[model samples]
Target: MRLSLKVWRQSNKEAAGGFEDYKLDNVSPDMSFLEMFDVLNEQLIEEGKEPVAFDHDCREGICGMCSMYINGRPHGPLRGVTTCQLHMRSFKDGDTIVVEPWRAQAFPVIKDLVVDRDAFDRVISAGGFISVNTGNAQDANSLPVPKEAADDAFAAAACIGCGACVAACKNASAMLFVSAKISQLALLPQGQAERSIRAEKMVAQMDAEGFGACTNTGACSAECPKEISLENIARMNREYIGAKFSSSAV
Candidate 1:
């Protein structure tokens, strides 16, 4: 397939950025999106031009590092898939594809299509883990988790921190990502000890990181590669309110 790419180019976070155009020919339909970029890079290198820079690792989609905005959508037009998992066949021949990095204050561009997502790490660090001593691995049957709760927790835990939620939201909210992390731990028995403070701290950290408030437009979940439910956001709000009330009562 032949294609035209309009990709964002930035030297660093403080550098002014804009789109640069390139044309690619003889692209294979079976090639992963990154592979197509690789081909483009090869051509650029052979022509003595600087190659496009994009983040990618574990191209099978597990890493969530391939965080590109393709044609105005996070990870292209596909559902439940990351940019690394997106295939060239998803596009038509002679199509013009617009690619950009995650456009959020919290995710400032480093260069080209790469953005600094360390803000997510900071949010998780605030209160996304269970500090209690649960000891070594116990028998699965020893603590029988309710089927529904376990399923829901696992679903929430599937979030890959890709920042698509931020990119998808006009407000650049990290609520969906933060909520998923909170929900995953809050739904499990092991996470109960920290539950009260977890929601408050993480939400506070998210705000400190400059992420915007949830728009209530549901764009985050719709573009989420993991399909993390919007319900997690509601759960997080309840947890936060409950935590605040309990703290004030003391």
Candidate 2:
């Protein structure tokens, strides 16, 4: 397959950036999107031109580090797949692909296709954890969690913090990602001790980081590679409201 890529390029976070076009020929349909970029980079290097910079850790799609907005969609046109998991075959021969980084104030572009997603890490640090004592591991049967709760918790925990939720939102909201993190713990018994505080702190931090409010547009879940549900957002809203009420009642 042959492709024309119009990719964003910037030298640094403060540097002005714009699209630079490149033509690629003889691309394999089986090649992952990152692999195609690798080929492009190699060609640029041989020509003494600077290579495109993109974020990618595990090509297997587990890391959520391959953050490219392909043709105006997060992670290309595929559903339930990350950028690294996107195949060149998803495009047609002679296609013109436009690639850019996540476009949210919270995720400022560092370079070509790499954005500083440390805002996510900061949100996680605010309160995305359980308070468990350090000791030998407890028996799995000790708590005896309800099957429904357990299932939901596990599903919510599948979120990989990819920031697609933010990229996909018209408001650039992090609600889906934040909700997934909150629900994963809020649904589990191990997370009870910090339940009341988790939602408040994380949501507060999310706001502090300049992430926009959830508009209920559902774009976040639609573009999420993990298929994290919108129900998580509802759960988070309940958790936050309940926490506020509980605190005020005291």
Question: For model 1, how does the per-residue alpha-carbon lDDT over 1-250 read when each residue is reduced to its tens digit?
Answer: 9999999998887899999999998999999999999999999999998888899988987787889999999999999999988999999999999999999999989999999999999999999998745678767688768999999999999999999999999999999999999999999888988898889899999999999998699999999999999999999999999998895434
Clash count in backbone of candidate 2: 0
The ten-residue window of minimal lDDT in model 2 covers 241-250
Q: How accurate is candidate 1 locally (lDDT)?
A: 0.93
Candidates in order, TM-scores: namely: 0.96, 0.98
Model 2 agreement with the true structure over 86-165: per-residue lDDT tens digits: 99989999999999999999999988889999999999999999877899988988987999999999999999999999
What alpha-carbon RMSD in Å does predicted model 2 have with respect to the real structure?
Answer: 1.2
List pairs with backbone clashes in candidate 2: none
Error of 2 at 236 (Å): 0.4
